[model samples]
Target: MCRNFVILLFFHICGCKELFDFRDKNKGSNCDVVFLSDSVKNGTITSPLYPSPYPARTICRYEFQGRGKERVQTIFQEFNLYHPRDDNRECDNQDTLIAFVQIEGRMEKIDTFCGSTLPRPVMSNGPRLKLEFHAVYGSRYSRGFKATFSFIQNFGIKVGVQLPDYPCAFVFNSNETRSGHFYSPNYPGFYPRDTECYYFFHGNQGEKIHLHFNYFDVEGVFPCEAKSASDYVEFSNFVSQDRKYERHCGQLGEFDIESDRRFFRVTFKSNDRLDGTGFNATYQFLDKVESFTTRSELTNETAVLKDIDGFITILFFLMIKLIR
Candidate 1:
């Protein structure tokens, strides 16, 4: 029954080919304020008056475009947007950082964040991404944000973007990379908020998977327990009910989990409030126990046991008749 559930869920949310059909979209129209473009495979962007207080009543917009069907991924190296109300600390209230994706001609707002914590990495659904910063009237207590962006190249039919090496930040999915060496969006650097990355690992038949983390850090400083509202990494198996998942946060250095079947899955989720530098991990296939017998041999053994039981029953009946 558990196996059936996994198979059902797997087919329910998958399709690789035709990942993006860049439609009749107005090219880079999401920037409503002062429009700017920095076309680079790897680069950085900072708020208007970064390191100093950002200007009041200002809106700055930027766009990162990848070649053809390629997509953009970004990391928030430093974030210190002003809070209009320190007590309430609303990101949309004063200075804010927002990310948008233009997919099939429609612009969708992907994330919005403010305050001190570095959020998780952000990945675009398509080839282009729009980034905006809005600062309201005052910059009294503010230090602007700094962000980095990179273009991700597509390799083959699976249709997912390839993740760069770690110690940096970005939203990363590992379904297509079966090699099992995947990292949190920005490793060594702090991750972003309102982020969720999924990884699916598959092993050879008759083999299991070994997964371990080299480093992990996430936000749990503010309590929002009812919704499991902490920045954490969750694990599960997609091929079986070996659902012993591991969730880690806040400077956990070394942790590991194993898979019961050929398929393993992992997820990293963060809240909009606070976060830390994310995690890094590796996975490898391991051979199963060698004392196993094939199905035909096992069936033959069962048949032999049944035959012996029948012979004993007949002998008992004969003895009873003789006694009578």
Candidate 2:
């Protein structure tokens, strides 16, 4: 009995030690960073030594991954970083706080901030958000920052698009194969500054995604300022970062896009200024590949084409003859 008790206690100690090992991986000497894979509706993020000057040579990244069509939003409860100059990443400047999205399976920075000026509430675009904090060795570190964030469910409302949920990139899986509509975060409302939103659409088997743009208005000129340039909308058949099939900006009338594959994506980004009413759009499943027309209808169309071709040929010959 005594021997059995010793073995049991040993096993328990081993188990506890393993648990601590896992936690230590998530711990830094003076940084707190995490990759939240689960759905987190509410939480707080703060520097490791918050309320005091953070340690020099520190780096942290917090990535929040939304569940399904959900997006994340964050409000800065407190922010104070050392920004001696306006430039944040000049090396030997000041501490820097940055926001990024997973593009092409890599972290692509979308915005950066420094200084005592607190940033406006920012949201992610798509299901994934990557936040970075670098306490470079520089002047005395300022008081670290504190923030609270939450997840928002986007069920595709039509009335108006809002931006609180720029915690973005709506992703649809095989389970959500039915027809649907996707509006901007707040359709009729003014979007927030430095906002990014992503929408991942996966079509059902044997079908492609069809989209109709009821309204599209954003800042900047067309083509040049659209897409990844400034405040614009982008569409991609594949879900890689910065890989765009078509990018759109400016006020648009009725327009439609048909996907060639079962996977597609759309993203909307707003800079710090000049936001508009945003966009309202709808999506449906289409099967152009497997579709067929009646035989008689096909024959009729072919005959019409032949007749037009013959008439055009004759007209061309007559004009040539007249010239001769």
Candidate 3:
């Protein structure tokens, strides 16, 4: 009889499919802001070569689902600011303020929303800035689904002095040399031979500027060659005889830097030789960066060990049999 009752309850719940459906809909539409940074606090802004000297107070907020059965897990992340020195700085306009966010554990659904654009204007008399992201869901039985989002923000300003400009060049050498070639299937073509990319920002002489580098990889290749902490790097600034300040260098992997100059260059050199065969090295941008935090709560409802009516009925039958 107890088994029969349990079966009945299960069917009853299955029949009321709208119950879970309605619950899911309600939960999806709801947004719970889980974290808020104080209007004023000190934090560091990190980049490739330069680290911002002064800490600036930046505000952040996040929203998540709050409902029944289907638990909602929301994560909050903050990134160091990419503060450009001045309004006319070319580097400021070119560099992207990219950040990453991740969610871990069983997630029935997920979403992320971003504001229309970066340097999202600060509200008058308000210290906090707002950003939005949409939700993305994970597959069933996939308890932990991690996701990351990255974007660029431009701060219209050049905060430092303009340095002398330098001429930048890129030379590609393979077992074969072809003009106007985009990609190569050979060894030297695959691996970076030197750093030769550069960016220039407008500023005065002797002024200081900060550069930050955040690296990531998507191919799951560990110890891959690119712009990262392991590599030995250097930066310089100068003005050109043409009166235009420029930054220049050899071939370097994917990276971003902030400096005061009109001309810039990056040089790239491979650390080890690649096999002459196979497509081993492919030029690509680093993966997005991300971080996360989680919280969980249990409901007040308690589970019943057994049906009270069924227990009593069984006990009565057993007592009668014993008397007989």
Model 3 CA deviation exceeding 4 Å by range: 1-29, 39-133, 136-138, 142-245, 248-324
Candidate 3 has its poorest 10 consecutive residues by lDDT at 14-23
For residues 1-324, write the lDDT of model 3, one tens digit per residue. 332221111112211111111122112221212222222122222221122211112122232222221111112233223323335333333223322222232221112222212231111001122223222221122121122211111111121222234222232222122111111111221222111222333223333233333231122122333543222223454522232322222333444343343222222222221211111121111112211111211121212234666788899999999999
- Ten-residue stretch with the least lDDT total in model 1: 12-21
Candidates 1 and 3: which is better by TM-score? 1
Residue 312 alpha-carbon offset, candidate 1, angstroms: 34
TM-score of 1: 0.47
lDDT of each: 0.59, 0.63, 0.24
Tell me the TM-score of each prediction against the true structure: 0.47, 0.45, 0.18
Show where candidate 2 strays beyond 4 Å.
Answer: 1-32, 35-39, 86-92, 138-141, 155-217, 222-324
lDDT-superior candidate, 1 or 3: 1
Give me the displacement of residue 44 in model 2, in angstroms.
0.7
- Model 3 per-residue lDDT at 255: 41
Give the Å shift of residue 34 in candidate 1.
9.9
